[model samples]
Target chain A: MASPPRLRAENLRSALAGPFDVSVAAGRCLAVTGASGSGKSLFLRMIADLDPNTGEVWLDGRARSAFTAPAWRRAVAYAAAEPGWWTETVADHFPDLPAARAMAARLGLKEALLDGPVLRLSTGEKQRLALARTLLRASPVLLLDEPTGPLDEDSVGRAEALMRERLAGGAAIVMVTHDPAQAARIGDEHLVMRAGKLEPP
Target chain B: MNPIVLTPRDLAVAAILLLVDAALSVALRLGLTRALGIAAVRMVLQLLFIGYVLQRVFAIASPWLTLGVLLLMTAVAAREVAARPERKLRRYGNEAVGLIAVGFATAIASILALTTALRPAPWYDARYAIPLAGIVLGNVLNAASLALDHLLGGVVREKPAIEAQLCLGATIGQAMAPLRRAAVRRGMLPVINQMSAAGLVTLPGIMTGQILAGLDPIQAVKYQILLMFLLSGGSGLSAVAIVYLAGHRLTDARHRLRLDRLA
Candidate 1:
């Protein structure tokens, strides 16, 4: 008998999005592309249970409802495109400073940047740092929204390599992006979101 | 010493002081003349009505009557607290939160003062309990209302930061910790200022009233000091209670930021 998919969303519906059903196996990446208001972000939020939605999401055949919201989020981590910073300094957000520094270096960011105030970082720098922060969790399933939207070619390549590394370690990824070429390069399967529904591109 | 009694003629002479305020409003085109006149009339009527009610209650000296009056005062204060906030909880949630915080703090403070400090004959004596409860409720209502207003406004303003914490696997309480602390601090600020300024920049109202009623200056000062401590303790308790209750109401069992709960 075949093993159950690593992550599965069945009949997921939110106020602004969904009625979506999809499956992603271990060690695979599913790239989603959509127009600006196509509810791509909302879809990811519903899957992570960050918003109020009606859905059944399963990780390794375990129901999302079975685990507490925080536990489920910890297992299925969502990295927002424009993540918010609560503290004044960047170092306060990360639990392991050394690990975060390593991840920052891997994402083409300066290790010294971590010690400075968060307000000083540029938009692309903040995006990369946020990705590093999320990656440190090493969740079994990763939900990424426009992770490379603000990065340059070199930075994007570094980020894609890092994501591929996670995938190789048996982590499933669902990424929302606008760049079709990048999706083709990084995505095992490409899907387009239109009017809150996913479709084959 | 016996205090000088103010007759109806004395009050009519006092009414002339408000005419100066009305004249200033008219001269400045401040559009407050009518409001000032209505407010003056309302204050006189309300104070006179309360005086009459208190006289009857004191004459009867019944516990149930005192309790009834206290509850009525608390309900009215709770309504006022709930009404002050711009972003209110939906369907009387604010009122309920206000009542719990205000009622609890007022009761605790009043009972402590009446039993320990004053030692009124019955302890639930209307003369002591009603006035003390009224004073404590007045301070607590302000603090609780300020805390609720700050919290509701902060939740809306800091949605992104709060949601980010929730996404990072924080429980509702953990996520809202900073905002809650800030709201409580904001609520307690006024009382802190008042306490610091008492006997220095300004004499508190209770102390001034007691002195004017021909009580010994030292006795009035002691009462004022006792009141300052009680007011601070009561305000802090109410502020903390209301902020936490409102925080729970804003989130849900699933730890989601339920902004839809606000009206």
Candidate 2:
């Protein structure tokens, strides 16, 4: 029998979003595209268990309730659109400096930017840094919500490349984005969220 | 020197102080004159009523009565803590957190004082237990309220940041660590300020009251120092407890923030 999908949502319904089901296989990306306020982000939050919802989510055949929240979150990371950084210096966010540097470079960030204060970074820089921070965890799956919302075209391309690399390495991803081309470029499967429900692209 | 007893006639003369305040309010057109007058009347009535109640409480000296009074005070303090915050836990949540945090601090602090420091003939003597508990409760109430306010407001303001941290695999405690620290610090700030400026800025109310009541300056100073230390301990414990409890209330078992807990 084929291995269970890497990430599976079974009738996961958020307070504001739907009772929807979807699955993404390992080494694949499922891109969710929707208009603003169409519940794409809400769907991701539900899968990540960041919002109160009905139904069950299974990761690699393990029920979400089986693992502790921290462990589940570590395994299936959620990268929010507007990421939060608690420290003053950028490097403080990542545990390993060398890995952080490598990830930063992969996301088009300069090495010196690590030592600088996070408050002074531009919006695009912050966005890319947030993604780098999430990717640094090497979680088995990624739930990305508009991960490249603020990046320019070149940065977007670099981000897409990094995501493609993650998918190539056998990590499953669920990404919410407004860019159809982004969906077309990296997504192995496509779902559009509308009126709080998921539909075929 | 003996402290002179003030007759009603003598008290009438002291009442002139309110007129001075009223006059100042009128001169500045601050419109506080009527409020001041009403407040003065209210203070007089409340103090007299409380004085009568304390006399009866001391005479009875019942442990059950003492516990009842302490619980009542705790409930009132908890309500104040809940009401002062612009953002707060839901009514029942606020009350529960406040009662637990403030009640715990006050009980521990007062018990320590009674058993170790005061050591009255009866450890449960209302004179020492009630007053000590009241003073400690008053200070802890302030600390607890400040902590709850800071924590509730911080959670709302930092929702995006907090959720982000949660998204990054932080446990609930890890996600809320910064705001929790901030809330505790804010709660303890008043006590810290009082300690730092004790001699320089203003003589504290307790020391001044003792001095005015004919205690020796040195004796009053010793008592003030002890009281300050107790206040510090009480405030710190209360602040930390309130923040931690409030933090727990704001999140779920899944480590996700439940903003709906807040009003």
Candidate 3:
């Protein structure tokens, strides 16, 4: 029999989104798609424990309540659709400049992008850099919202490739996307959110 | 040197000064004429009441009375500090914390000054303790309020950045470090400016009052210097303490951003 889910959510309900359940096994991707304003991002946020909700989220069979918010966040990383940057230089966000450069390169970012200030980056660049930052966290479970929304075809491919590498490395991923073809290609299990309920695609 | 005492006639002459200010306000349509009139009445009433109260309290020289006055001032200061934040603590939360912080800061500075520089018989002399505590409490209260206001505003404005840091595995302190630093700098700005401008752009109140009361100019300046140093230390301590205390309240034991605590 396959092992239990690496990330699990039971009865997760926000005021806007209802009591939903989800489970993703190791080395698998669960893609959640929904219409605009359909609580897709809210669902992702609930899983990441960023928003207030009623639910039990289990990581590696351990309840989320067992971990501090910081530790839990470290285990279950979140990449927001509209990411926030605080520092001036892009390199300031990363722990290792060379490693960040490598991740940037993998994400199709130019080497010089890391040296420039974050304000100078394009929306696409900022999104990709945010992805790089999230991935650098090395969490076991990843929650991504519109990871490719701002990207070009080449960068989307690069991002998908990176997600594939992580999935192959036994990390569980719950991604929110609008593209059906991308879902079919990358998702191990696909769920559509309608009227705040998760259903089979 | 005999200080010039202001009699009733002298005070009436001083009241004419308000007419000049009122005239200017009326000419400029500053809308401050009524405010100035009300303030003049209020200042006279408040000062007179305090003057009588101080005379009675000093005549008795009771430690209990001295302590009561200090505590009352601190409580009032705490309330003033608690009132300015947009995101207030659950009723009396910031006020209680403010009380303790402002009280402790005022006590430390007052005790140090009273014991060493200007020690009086019986230590808790109303003349020394009450006035010193009032000055310290007033300055410290402003600093604490400014710190909390900046902190609340910063947290709201930088919610995305703060949440981003938390999502990246940063602890509450780690996520809030930049905001806290900025808040502290902003909170201390007025005090810092006062320090820089003292005797240059403006004559500080304590110095001007002392000089007018016929103290030697050099002696008044020395006392002013001492007060400046005391206020800097007291305000800095109160500002930092309030920030740290309030910052902790903004998060939970799990180090989550309790943005809901904010308005």
lDDT against the true structure, per candidate, is: 0.92, 0.89, 0.87
Docking class of 2: medium
Measure candidate 1: CA RMSD: 1.8
What does candidate 3's lDDT look like per residue over A1-201, in tens digits?
765689999999988897898889999999989899888988988887877788899998999998988889989999899998778888888987888899999998898999899889999999999999998878899999999998999999999999999999999999999999888889999999998889987
lDDT of 1 by residue, A1-201 (tens): 999999999999987888999999999999999999999999998998888999799999999999999999899999888888878899988999999999999898999999999989999999999898888899999999999999999999999999999999999999999999989998999999999999999
Record all residue pairs in model 3 with backbone atoms less than 3 Å apart, i.e. clashing. none
Over the stretch A59-144, how does candidate 2's per-residue lDDT look in tens digits? 99999999898888889999888888777888888889998898888888898899999988998999998899889888999999
Model 3 per-residue lDDT tens digits across residues B119-224: 8887778998899889888888888889988988788888888889989888889999998888777778888999999999999998899899999989999988
Could you give candidate 1's per-residue lDDT for residues B48-87 as a string of tens digits? 9999999999999999999999999999999998999999
Model 3 TM: 0.92
CAPRI-style quality class for the chain A–B interface of candidate 1: medium
Residue A23 of model 1, lDDT score: 97
The most accurate candidate by TM-score is: 2
Question: Each prediction's TM-score against the native?
Answer: 0.95, 0.96, 0.92
Docking class of 3: medium
